[model samples]
Target: MTTRQDGERRRGRRPGGTDTKAALLAAAREVFIEQGYDGATVRAIARRAGVDAAMVNHWFGGKEALFAQAVLQLPFNPQELIANLLEGDPDSVGERIVRTFLTTWDAQDGGVFAALIRSVASHDQVANALRDFFIKNVFSQLASVVSVDGRAELRANLVASQMIGLGMVRYVAEFEPLARTDIDTLVKAIGPTLQRYLNGPID
Candidate 1:
């Protein structure tokens, strides 16, 4: 058994604990940011964190899970979030989506959004990660539920555009009343537009 001092000195395979997990998360975040989701390896992250790569599997299951937690920092699991949004009135999913998004990102004070945008800007892999994160895992699933007449792809694109634009203007550009507006106020203003995107008829 590796004692505390021995474990500290060895630094090869860290025993499971809050500190080891935290170190892995911090290291994963940095590695994902620097190398992006595709390029960032579990071994590299574990090496940086001074832990065994197997610990990543123990704590996070795998690289994708680690990326989701450390880099995406999602407020909720992708599937759970989708399911929750789908539970309410079908017509009102758009509003719920907008509300949930604003509330979650707002709670983080835009740090996650800003970091993702920066990563997407600096790294192509990050852009792909953003696409997979938002488009495949989130928006497309939502669109598949409510979209009309095989328009899931288009609806997904529309929702992504609206949300990404809103995030950019509010978090990145820091433009005027929008950046300062209360969540409910923005939701009321933007909800209908997204509703139309999701529920609108396409010819």
Candidate 2:
């Protein structure tokens, strides 16, 4: 009953089932790079992946999450990560954020983040994709949640500046003691400032 196309599908990517996630991620990356964030549609990515559009929702929760995983190459879901970051003692959220950031990048030896930093320099789409993502998904949401001073937007940007700077120095620039500093030390040192950005004065 098996056909040549079936054999080929078995060797490479298939229409649905177990291959859906990988196929969708592959397709999402292509579509996001080619179409940009605003232009890339769920149907288009699903069509490219040769799967049902609902599969995108089923696997990734929706377009934004898909973009985060596919384009940003983030290891976890942004929304869920934010929600988890919001849990427990509110004051320590920034510490958790720093810890999580270091852990995620360190696990990959900063390879993924390093590549992203490099790609952002030369590729407009990559830069646009990154701007469309972390700024909105990670920064805005987390900052907004803890913001009591109505400065969520500014706070978000500040927090972002810190993380972006940290990534560049530690991963890309490979600068000094900061690069070799342990995650715990970085968290303890940077966390209070981040907490202030999210909850403290910015006048």
Write down the lDDT of every candidate, Cα atoms only.
0.77, 0.77
Question: How many angstroms is residue 6 displaced in model 2 relative to the true structure, after the best TM-score fit?
Answer: 13
**What value does the lDDT take at residue 61 in candidate 1?**
91
For model 1, what is the alpha-carbon lDDT of residue 168? 94
Cα displacement (angstroms), candidate 2, residue 62, comes to: 15
Best-fitting candidate, measured by TM-score?
A: 1
Model 1 C-alpha lDDT per residue in residues 148-195, reported as the tens digit of each score? 677777777888788889999988788998998998898888888888
* Candidate 2 local lDDT, 1-203, one digit each (tens): 33555444543555567688898898887776676666789988877777778889999999877876886765556678777778878888889989988887787656556656665775676677778876767666675456767777778888888998999999889999999999999999999988888887778
Q: Estimate the TM-score of every prediction.
A: 0.75, 0.69
Steric clash pairs (candidate 1): none
